[model samples]
Target: MELLFIERISTEQLEDLHRISVHTFRSNYGHLNTPENLQQHINQHLSKERLKTELEHPEMRFFFAWVDGKVVGYSKLNTGQGQTEDYGEDQLEIERIYVLEEYQGNGYGGALIQHAEQQAKTLGKSNIWLGVWEKNPRAIAFYEHIGFRKIGTHTFQVGQDPQTDWVMRLSL
Candidate 1:
């Protein structure tokens, strides 16, 4: 495997962001969801326009992981008010950390989490948190392995379907 490198993504890379976001989401969850629901979720949340707006947020940062010049994963980090939930000023959110299915186990996701932690620490944050689908045991286990503890639950929408997400936090 080629060594992976991480770079901050700029607005000029909106197309790449959109493509990877949608593709990774679909690859990860499409089989478990109805096609209609998957399409609706992608159209609503992962559109290029929405991504561009998100990229412009002052408190949100995006990063892409590349291996041998190919983009294989991405992460979104939010601080201050850009966080999906109000976890206070000392807390940062790992809003999204996704790797392409083919790239799993390559350490990109773990690297992204480490990056998030470093960002939070540099910003004087004491904690980093994220919501993982309750049904995703793999993600939950990964978080646990990384020292995250379940703190609460939140409601997340996948198209029109209501789902539960476990909020996990790691104190830095």
Candidate 2:
């Protein structure tokens, strides 16, 4: 198998991030959400304009995972005020990490997590954290297997549906 490559996302790659963000999101959650709700969520969060704004934000960073020159996954990390929750200045949040369905079960996800940790270390963060949807046992297990511990739970909104997310953290 070709090794997956990780790179920091550039402004020119915003549209690619948008595309993979939507594709991976829908592929993973479309079945559980109403079509209208899913579309609404996508439009609100993954639209090109919104992603551009996010990409321009100084405290947030985005990266892409590539295989044979094609984007196969992506991740978003937040620090300072960009963090979704107030976890302090020494913490970095893994706000988003998704691998395309075809790449699931491969090591891309782990590679992304390792990338996030390295980013955190570079930023002088002592801990890395993220909120995984409670219903996503697979993701939760992956995090746990990677040394993250469930510290708490929070509510996340996907259109009209309110979902619970397990707040997991790893001390570096």
Candidate 3:
């Protein structure tokens, strides 16, 4: 197996970040949503400008997963005020984690979560959490297999659609 390398992304890599963000997201969720809704969601949330701003945020971090010099996945981690919900100072939120469809079942997702765990521990956070769309059973199962437990539910907006997400947490 090829080694999967994960590295923190910088503001200078905004274009690569934006490209993968939109591609992975649309590939994962586009089939389940209308074109208009998908477009709206991408424009509002994954726009280059928005991503650039986020890349510069002190409390937020983005990481790219690379295999043989090719990017295959990415994750977004948040702490402090950057978190969508205030889970308190001792928790780190994994706002996003997406692996390209071709890379599914290859252990990249687990590696990303492991990287997130290391980051959380480095930040002195006692727990790590995330909101997974209720519709994505595969992802929910993956998180559960990694010892995350469902703690609650939250509404995640994608365009005008209000989607339900299960809040899952793992204590470090």
- Candidate topping lDDT: 3
- List the candidate numbers ranked by TM-score, top first: 3, 2, 1
TM-scores for candidates 1 onward, in order = 0.97, 0.97, 0.98
1-172 per-residue lDDT for model 1 (tens digits): 5787889899999999999999999998998888988899898889998899999999999999999899989999999989999999999999899999889997788988988898899999999999999999999999999999999999988888888999999999
Candidate 2 lDDT over residue span 1-172, tens digit each:
4688899898899878988999988998999889988998999999999999999999999999999988889999999999999999999999999988888888889999999999999999999999999989999889999999999999888998889999999999
Clashing pairs in 3: none
Q: Per model, state how many residue pairs clash.
A: 0, 0, 0
The prediction achieving the highest TM-score against the true structure is 3
Computed on alpha carbons, the lDDT of every model, listed in order, comes to: 0.93, 0.92, 0.95
Ranking by lDDT: 3, 1, 2
Total clashing pairs in model 3: 0
TM-score of the candidate numbered 2?
Answer: 0.97
Q: Who is ahead in TM-score, 2 or 3?
A: 3
